[model samples]
Target: MRGDRVTNEGTVPSDSRRFCLYFAHIELAQKVQAGREAKRTLHEAGVAIKKQIIANTKSNKSERHKHLDELEQDLKILENELKEKEELKRQAEIPENAAKERHQKLWKVEKRAMQDLISRNNQMREMFADLDTNGDSLISIDELQKHRELDTNPENEFTVEEVRSILGSDSIDLNKFNTTVFDQLSNSYGKLLEPTRPTPEPTPLAEPSIDSITTQPSSLEIPTDEEDLRTHTRSSYKNEDDSEDDYEEYNHRGSSSIATSLEHEKHIHDSIAPEYDDETKRLIQIADEARNRYHEVGEKLLSIKRQIDDSKKQSSVDTGLHDEYAAIIDQCFDYEEREYTYRICMFKTANQIPKGGGSEVTIGYWDSWCGPKDNKYLKMKYSNGATCWNGPPRSLIVTLQCGTEQKLTDVREPSRCEYAMIFETPLACDETIATTSAHLDHVEF
Candidate 1:
């Protein structure tokens, strides 16, 4: 104690620290037990006073009646005092119990965090082992950069120098500073990490009752565009008389009933043909010319359409590409699954046609091609077509692979109101790319 500035010099040693903590814990436990005992004493004292009062209530009244009131007052006072002590005990324990519960919850959280760290640590160890394949306990820069997937950002992929900087050397020791290695690996290659998804159990495919969309025999030929068809029809009927104008109007209304057209023709010949007096002969001649021209032009237009089809097909073959050539449109692919034949029309829609002669139902309409442009195979989506009984609007994903002919390989409804079809089509072929790539490879050293 120099100059009255007295200071304690003894410091606790490391080996005795545990004992000191244990002693403090014991003291806390003793204090808690003492508080509990005090509350119990107060409760017992109140119970004894209650029993004494009850015993005095039935005793000889002449001797103790004067003290009976005093005894009753004392009992009430004791009860009140006991209640106050109990309340005090509860108030004292509340913060302690709350703190205990909070500590328990925090411990659980920390435990889980530690477990996750252990898991991540083990994963890192395995990755390092794989990267250090040479058994030198060090991963070289070349080996590290070989996995370009390690670059989390594709736009700013790691250069060799960046990788070396991250490694802190030309090579990284697998056993040294594991946490640092884990962090660096995570920062660079975490996106390449594959996460597992929980797969659902397979469910049986459902079959729906068929509904009719059409009655005519299904034709495989591509339908002409409306603009082209309109042009052809206008040119073909330009020379027809006014009498034929009504028929053209009927046709333009999209009537497919041959019976109706025939009936109208009969009406013209029977009713209208007899109205003209002396001009009947000339009108008859004119009607005959118009009829002849109509049939001739119809035949010529059909022949010309067929020729155009043949030329487009030939051009597709010459170019050695099908779907990309613009000439292979409106093609149909039929896939039979269970009891239904799914007919998917390219650039149009898909139909669920029953095999046992039921109505054809529209399942989906062509939305667009669904993947990257340069991909050899095609993924097309048909959407907003049919309505399911208890589900959303039906949709189909049609996957097309190159083949010699058009046909379906597989059909499945993998989810409710959603269909998947794998089909083969000559239109999917890209022979030009395939052949040139192969030839170039042969010419290389």
Candidate 2:
């Protein structure tokens, strides 16, 4: 055995030798193709966003705004879809399964981007339909010039030469006609698209024809008395059933107040009956003066009714406050300052009466209700007052403080032409002192 071992070299059996190694089995060719396809899709979408269908380089603000808004919406949708597909792929454990699903998802996104391009082009087609007046699928320079003429301003004039230069042709096909040129035109002369109506035929002149003069109707009769005609000429607004008392009231008031009314009547009478004799005109004037007197009496009666209604409202006990302050609701709180006598009639308009003798001016009207229900006692806002000279409209805000007597303690102009007043009133307290003290005692126990 020693002689045989010396002559033969020992060799390890191939199957008995053990080896362990790790490597990724990635399909490089498939990955490279998928990456190229994704890059191509992204490039196509970029080109679509910058697609231009118009001849002119100028862009309208409105159209640009619309395109940008739509592009943003599309991009948002694309991002959401990509996130959803990525989540789905991550959930799949097998690499082959994930790659196949990702490829399908990416194809869908590419299709969507292509649709956006088609939709944008379709918008241009619809606009071309509006501009194609002859329906020959073309827009001529002459047609554009005619539309330009509709603009009244001389500076707005558009020439055939300008149109040809912009369009680069005498007639633009449907595709080119609906480009940026149409957008600029629509912005400048959109109103010209409205169809104009045909001019109406004029009526024949009312000449004294021989047939009309010969065939004068027998029933035609003109009134002789101008005074009777004038009385019938009274406005249809006059009442037919006016009471005798109203007529008596009209006679009691002197004619001096109606002198202006009489002058207006005379002017109207002269214009209506210029061909009438002086006596006729005078009679018409007298009748008009009597009608005016009746109108003046009616106006006075209306004024009396308004005053009575106002008095009733002031005396009513419907003030929305505590019983103690109910009397103050309708009563006026007069605050006399250096230059003006201010009156704040509760739940009514505030007024500023000049002390030295100027017109009474309205400060503002009460706009909000102030009380416990609103969790406020003294905050009152008055707005829409009479306009100030060289300033904004006057407004006032009143803040009420607790006091025994109702008075306006201080006034200040905190802003330009705006007055803020601190008013003191007994009604400003929500809870009595005795009640608050009792509540505090209970809490301490």
Where is model 1 more than 4 Å wrong at Cα?
A: 1-282, 291-328, 372-377, 401-406, 425-445
Candidate 2 error regions (>4 Å): 1-308, 311-318, 321-325, 370-374, 438-445
lDDT at 422 for candidate 2?
Answer: 80
Candidate No. with top TM-score: 2
* 10 residues in a row with least lDDT, candidate 1: 205-214
- Candidate topping lDDT: 1
TM-scores for every candidate against the unseen true structure: 0.28, 0.29
lDDT for each of the candidates?
Answer: 0.52, 0.49
**Per-residue lDDT of 140 in model 1:** 83
Model 1 vs. true fold: TM: 0.28
Please write out the lDDT profile of model 1 over residues 1-445, one tens digit for every residue. 2223323865434545555666777676667666655544444443344334334433533333444445455555655555555555555455444433333332332233333433444455556656665767678888787767666565787688866766777887744424345556754653324323322112221111011211223221211444543353344334324224534443344312112101123223233322222223344455455555555555554554555554444334322222142333466767767788888876678999988897887889867667467762467788997899988989998886655555789888899889998866545544343332111111111
